[model samples]
Target: MPLHKIIHINETTTAYFWYITEDVTSLFRAVSLKDTSLFRLEGMKSEEHQRGFLAVRMLLQHLGYTDYDLSYDEAGKPHLSDGKHISISHSHEFSCICISNKLMGIDLEKLKEKTLKIAPRFMEVKHLENLTTSEQIEKATVIWGVKESIFKIKNEKGISFPEHIFEDEFDLKDGKCTAKLHFNNQIENFQIHFYNVEAYIFVCAFPNK
Candidate 1:
């Protein structure tokens, strides 16, 4: 397989969709086969995450980065040795990355039935009270994406829904929403951009503050 072309959703965000047919070898050649192989092995945990790593690697290469070094800090947040702000997400065959001069976060999740089944775990009573059956599942999915993006941005653990992060009520028609994030004794506002693509809800969050 040839090196699949990179797809850019925007100037700062790019997504690479991988199938088993893609040229994993070429990717390894561009970077280090040893490093790519380690991520490939992680496919056992979740093929989705593995594919995401491949896409992320491709994006990094496009940005003129050949040597990619990743390490986890004491808080378990991923840090790049080069000191760039990076965020990644993968779901099923698709993976996405957001690279920016400032802090950023991105999330992509497969629209699964489980999202609906466990909606209560993440939503607050106020959110539930306003949700109608018609839009409950869709709203819940957006909120999930928001929360995941927050986790990626903060790089810290132990946050609850409704209490820590609050999303403003939004309509699916708008295709986007905003949220207020409360963390680390600071109230930071954020804007969430949502994209409905190929049965998946992709959300990207940036701090407005």
Candidate 2:
């Protein structure tokens, strides 16, 4: 699939997803990559990762941009040339980018048992109580996505998932939630929206205003 889906998060933000079914050669030929990108792609160790990298560029081209329009800062956060905020993530076969006029973060994660098994390390395991096995996996994945999305937004050094980020209690039926980031002796709130995309969970977070 090309652009698999577009979620209009709000008037100012949109998320684009690309389903990666193309081989590395085909994807490489489709998009024009700047020299730096080409070098980075050549250095990748696996074809799966290479395809994901190229799929991100494909999404950019679909949006009337190119690799030249994308750059990253010292903190490894992506920036758009036209001054919009952009966040990118890829897992397994899906590549996605979220663009917003305001600062925000997006994360895509393939649901797996490992995330649920290690949930204790990053979140309050009490929140996972009383759910069926499947529901526990789904909810745990969403909470993990919430934390990852928020981390991408802050991108500050010394932030630990378990120590600084907390997802408020939320039900899977709600499709949204809130989180708190405790760092530097200050508390910051965030609004989160999440969805089930194929076998993956897509999460977006914005700093609470």
lDDT of 1 by residue, 37-94 (tens): 4654555475445445565666556666543465556775656667876676766666
lDDT of each: 0.66, 0.94
Candidate 2 local distance difference test against the native: 0.94
Error of 1 at 22 (Å): 4.0
Off-target runs (Cα >4 Å) in candidate 2 are: none
Give per-residue lDDT, candidate 2, residue 111.
88
Could you give me the TM-score of model 1 versus the true structure?
0.74
Per-residue lDDT tens digits of candidate 2, residues 5-109? 999988999999999999999999999999989999999999999999999999999999999999989899999999999999999999999999999999999
* Residue 88 displacement (Å), model 1: 0.4
Candidate with maximal lDDT: 2
Give lDDT: candidate 2, residue 129.
Answer: 93
